[model samples]
Target: LFVAGPILLVELYPARVEFAFYRMSLCTKLGGLCETDCLTFKEKTGSCRADLTPLCCRKGKKH
Candidate 1:
């Protein structure tokens, strides 16, 4: 038999929008590209879809 542990919900979300904002902000100060998908990201909160980007994936846990 196989055993499974408790599953978290946050792990399902991706951080694309958040990353874009952070990255863009930093890049702007450094005279880099301030790229951001305002249209799509505006509809999303802190976390986006998990299947989208792996960088924003969280286990609903605070690190």
Candidate 2:
């Protein structure tokens, strides 16, 4: 017998969706289209202020 566990979630957009909202796990202090081109982490301070994180969100689309 096999048991299925909770699925993993990520900040990824569905390929089928033409216009989808990109999401981040943690809310961004910066507003508007949080890009993920650059991300930085500081384990010493237990803080991460990357241009983006590993979280995705969903919003209503016009399609």
Candidate 3:
């Protein structure tokens, strides 16, 4: 049983890591930072597209 647990975890690990990257890719592609707040210098709060969570995007100030 213990050996089986290790094997299962190893098999599932790559898929879990890949899913994380896929989720982050969408947020990044939309030019958004997945942060709790958008409070920063030269940053504005905006919505993100194709994101699973409620993403607080920090957008740069337009010149």
- Per TM-score, the best of the predicted structures is 3
Model 1, C-alpha of 59: deviation from truth (Å): 40
Q: Whole-model lDDT for model 2 versus the true structure?
A: 0.29
**Candidate 1 off by > 4 Å:** 1-14, 35-63
Which whole-number lDDT from 0 to 100 does residue 1 have in model 3? 100
TM-score of 3: 0.55
lDDT of 1 at 62: 40
TM-score of 1: 0.29
Question: For candidate 3, what is the lDDT?
Answer: 0.62
**Local distance difference test values of all predictions, in order:** 0.36, 0.29, 0.62
lDDT of 2 by residue, 1-63 (tens): 123232222223243122222222233332222333323331121223333432322232345
Clash count, predicted structure 3: 0
Of 1 and 3, which scores higher on lDDT? 3
What TM-score do all the candidates reach, one by one? 0.29, 0.16, 0.55
Which scores higher on lDDT, 1 or 2? 1
Better of 1 and 3 by TM-score: 3
lDDT of 3 at 18: 78
Model 1, 1-63: lDDT tens per residue? 122222333432345556556654554454333223334322222332223331232123244
